[model samples]
Target chain A: MRRAAVSTLLWAYAAVALLPLLIMVWNSFRTDQELVVEPLGLPHSPSLDAYREAWVEASFSTYFLNSVLVTTLSVLLSTAVSLLAAYALARSRSRLMAVIEQVFVSGLMMPVFLMIVPIFYLLDTIGLASTRTGLILVYSAVSIPFSVFVLATFLRQLPVDLEDAARIDGAGPLRTFWSVLLPLVRPAVATVVVFRFVPIWNDFFYPLILVRDRARYTLPVGLTTFFGEYQTSWSTLFAGLVIATLPLVVLFLVATRQIVAGLTAGMGR
Target chain B: MNRRRTAALPTPVALLFLLPAAALFAVFVLYPMATALTYSLFSWRGTAQDAFVGPANFVALFTTEPYATQLPRAFGHNALLFAGAMVVQNSVGLLLAYALHHRGRLRRLFQVLYTMPYLVSPLVVGYLWSLLLSPLFGPVNAALRAVGLDAVARPWLGDPDTALWVVVLVTAWQWVGFPLLVYGAALGALDPAIEEAAMLDGASSRQRFWHVTLPLLMPVIGTVSVLTFIFSMEAFPIPYALGGSSGSPAGATDVMSLLFYRTAFHSGASNAIGISSAVAIVLFVVIVGISVLFTQWFRRVERRLT
Candidate 1:
């Protein structure tokens, strides 16, 4: 009886968790009129009209491309810089290095709202305001603290005998780091990459504030406006949401282990 | 091998390795934070900085008409969100984790399923929930009416009484997976011998859980609480997506972040920058202070456990 009760509770919670998405995908194929008439009913004949309308008319294609470009560039830039810094912080025993590490770690507490106004002014001063490049740069900066913390923690736990052996084999510092250390920390790198990717992909704040041009809008910002414009067209709005959500779902399915590992890494003793 | 060769990178090369991240962080994160501190001290004429008002902006924030009222209300909402998340999300997560730990069947699949909502954007999640809860055409109401329970159906997102709770529930729905995974991992790491010994001592499952497992899980619980506190206090996207930037339904769902956004960008108040920066600084101090204090306390507790 207890085992049955447990199973029932788990299954119920799982249904609650997934039913919304399933309903969304199920309804996206129906027309707005059909949805208004029967909000809970299945589509009579599934169609791609809503998808086509969202993709072609609503400019989700552009938003899709922009999201892809911005998320990819920002994650790559932040992860690359953080890896080098993590390596340095892991290896160095200097007092200054410790201070620098503290500086980066302290950034974990820095609120985005606090820095946003000044960042706007600073970006404008540098002529980067409203540009994808500027947004990418800000994303990188915001992501660096967490990336460094995770990578540095992982790097510290690694044994250094491999690096010593590489040095004995006449490998230079750069060569040793690139060839020896990099391969070993691949899991850490993957952890940082997955963790950074989701937030950057999902962030609407920076883009909403910094980017002015419609052409430059990322998916989250674009979807907000898209919803505004398509307020009456529920099916099309659902289609747009599905488009915004599908990539992450697919990615999660592909990389569940890595994502879980990254999420649960430091939580346990 | 020498200890130096084994551990230490040469200083020059280490600095070189650090340069890119240091530069980016200094220019973007550190510099802007410093500038925000400065901006919060002064008066502003539209976009331009004016006379140094010392703490007048902060004073106005606490004592003035709109801000005094708005700040406290928004702060209450945030506190409510934190408390709600702790009671609802974390508790549910612990139960789920405990069940999964014992069952072990389809654990990976369940983890993936449970965590799926977290991977999607909050904006999308918010929008999706808004549709589901929409009074006019939402299936929730439709199903309610269909079941002859029409009295239970109402404007969930439109009602001020229920709007903030909806946000809380949605936020919990998206994030419960985090605590679940964390607690699950902590449970897995626990030595089973202790629990077995308790079983031998004739402790009931409930007694063992309450006395043994719960105390051992205190550190992980503390960590989850701090994270939930931070996320709740800084919440934006769901509230923004569901309630708009002004935190609609007559500002019933207004949060500190939304308030800051409005004052800075939308309000067009003369000293918008100054006032908003003050708001930001207040939130920062609160978040950092509470987080540090709790983390230290949790560390002491963890040390005692061993």
Candidate 2:
């Protein structure tokens, strides 16, 4: 009886967690009229009207592609730069190295809001404002603190003998980083990739402020536009929400272990 | 001699490795911060510096009508959101962690499901909830109607009294997974023999939990609280999406971050980069203050535990 009670509670919590998403997917398939008339009922016809409307009329495809480009480029750039810095800090025993590590760790405390005003001014002055390239650079910059923090922490725990052996074998510092150390720290890289990619893909603030043109708006900003345009069209709006959420959900489902492991890597410590 | 011998790479080589990250950090973060400080001292319209305002913007932020009034109100909303998330989200997360810690088979599945929402954009989460709670066609109201609770199903996001609370609930719902996973891992690593000892001592389950398990979990709890507090202070997208950029419904769900963004960038409002910078500074101070306090307290608890 006690075991059954615990199981029931677990399942109850699961239901609460999943019910909204289930409702979202279900409503995405129905017409807006059907949604209003039968909000809780499953669609009788199961048409894809909402999805079709959102994709074609709402310009979700454009927004989707913009997000893909930004997220991909930013993650790649952030991971590479962070790995280099982490490799340097992790392997070196100099006081300067220690100080640099502390600096990056302290960078974690600096709020993004504090930088937003100045970043806008700086970007505008440099003629990079409202461009996808500009947003990509901003994303990469913002990701550095956490990326370095995670990568450095992971690297510190790794054995240094391999790098030393590579050096003894006449491998150059650059070569060792590329052919030796980088491959060994693939798990940490995966962690950084998963952690950075989701936020960049889901980012709204930078895109909202940086991208003035409607053509350059990322997914979150584009969704805001959709929300404004389709205020009363409930099913269509639901379909847009599902489309915005589906890629991340699919990515999370595929890389669930790595994502969770990356996110919670140091929490238990 | 020992340091030189043990060094893994040459100084120049190490510096070479660090250049890209350092340059990016300097250009984006450090440089911008310096400019934000300078900009806060001047009355700037967009990119043009009009005049040196010195501390007038900060003064107006503290003493004036809307800025002064709304800033505190927004902070109050942040406090309430922080408290609600701690009480509702973390508590449920704690319960879930306790339930799932020993159940090896289903833990991964539940963890992934609970955490999936966190990966989705907050914009999506906000819109998703708004749709879910739409009075005319939402499933929440439908369920309420089905169960004969029609009167209780009001316009959740439209009413000022309930709008802030709805944002709080939405944030908690999305974030509960973080604490669950953290606490679950902590719980799993706990030695089973300690719990057995408490059981053998004739302690009731409640006593065992409070006297044994709870004390052991204090350090993790402290870390989670600090994280939740920081996230709460920076919360924007949910309130922005649900309450509109104006934090409508009579500014019911206005938060510091949202207020800053609106004051600085909203085309409808007069651009007050100076005042907005002051708001950003205040927000920064509050976050740093809370983080220091939490870190000190956490250290104390960890010291006691050790």
Candidate 3:
């Protein structure tokens, strides 16, 4: 009886956490009248019109692709950098570690809002401001500290014997990390991908200022534009929200186990 | 053959691995931060070739109308948000972790559900909460009335006194699971015998937790607290959404992030990149100083605890 009641309370707490999303999903299905009139009730009948018009008319497909492209490039770039910096921090008791760690932490203080000012100037000077490359570099730079911190933590926890054994066999530093360490810390990569990548993917502040062109607009900014253009159309806006959010939801669903591991990786040590 | 071939090229090999990140950082991060300082010195708006003003921007920013008010509010709300996150996120996380500590079946279900909020964009989180608290038909008020608590309900995001806290709560709701998951792992590593020992010595469940569990979890708490503090400081979404495009309700929740946004590309105002750059510089210095202070404080606490 106690266990059942405890589980019930836990479920209630979980439901509270999920309440807004549940409401979003529920509201997205209802008609405007239904939404306002009986907001909490199940739709008398579900309709696909919102999802359909949202996808076809609003260019949500393009926004989705833009998110995919930006997130992919950003995560790849972040992961690549993190692997090297993390490896160095993990293996070498190099005095450089202290300095580099300081750099990373300070770099975290570089607000994305502030970066817009200088980066716009820099990118314009180089003719890359509104370009995809501009957003990619900005994202990778901001994310470097986090990626390095996470990857370094994971890398430090691994046993060093395999790498040592490989080094003795004349394997180089790069080769050992690639063949041996990469597989071991795949979870860390996934964690970085989820945590770091999601920010860049759904990054509204950057894409809003940096990329003015509609063609290059990532999902977050694109959805904002969609909201302004179709300001009165709540249904379509909700639909776009659903579309903009699906990829991360998909990523999370696939990596559900890894997500837990990722957060817990820092614990105990 | 083995010895000679093995010794071939280990020096530049690892250097190649570090190249991508280092080069990107040099050109983008390092360059931009340097340029921010240089741009601060100049009065131009970062467009069209113009003459440099040389420290004029900094002087004006210090004495200017918005900067004087702007810097403090941004820093103040930034501090408040940091505090809210620490208390709400850390406490709630610790509680959930405690609930899940001995429970298994419920753990799997709750873990997945709790993590859903962190996966979405903060803007969206803000938007979703706004939807729930719309004053027009927000489900929050709806629930209040439903449960016969109508007297206690209020428009959360519209009021001055409540908007900041609403933003804080919305932001916390999004990331609390993350810290909890982190702390849960920390708790699991704690020696079960410590709690057992306390229980045998006539300690209550609360006492065991307070005396035994809490101390052991300090390091993880330090890490999660610092991470939350830094992210909350720079985070732009909660204030932007809850405060609306204008960061409104008379700029009550207009934080540094939003202020920097407004002064720059105009998060909801006019676009003046020069002044925004100056704001950015100010924000950068303040955040760095705060980060240093936080680390020092954490070090002090760690020392005392040890």
Better of 1 and 2 by lDDT: 1
Whole-model lDDT per candidate: 0.91, 0.85, 0.75
Q: Candidate 1: count the clashes.
A: 0
Interface RMSD of 3: 4.2
Cα-based TM-score, every candidate: 0.97, 0.96, 0.87
Give the alpha carbon lDDT tens digit for every residue of B89-185 in model 1.
6578899999898887898888878887877888899999999998878988999999999999999988999999999889889878788888999
Q: What is the lDDT of residue B37 in candidate 1?
A: 84
TM-scores of chain B, in order: 0.95, 0.93, 0.86
Model 3, runs deviating above 4 Å: A1-8, A81-110, A148-185, B1-9, B45-56, B148-156, B267-274
Clashing pairs in 1: none
Candidates' DockQ values?
Answer: 0.75, 0.66, 0.44
Evaluation by TM-score, superior candidate among 1 and 3:
1
Considering every candidate listed, which one attains the maximal lDDT? Answer: 1
Once fitted onto the true fold, the runs of candidate 1 whose alpha carbons sit more than 4 angstroms away are B1-7, B296-306
Worst 10 residues of 3 chain A by lDDT: A92-101
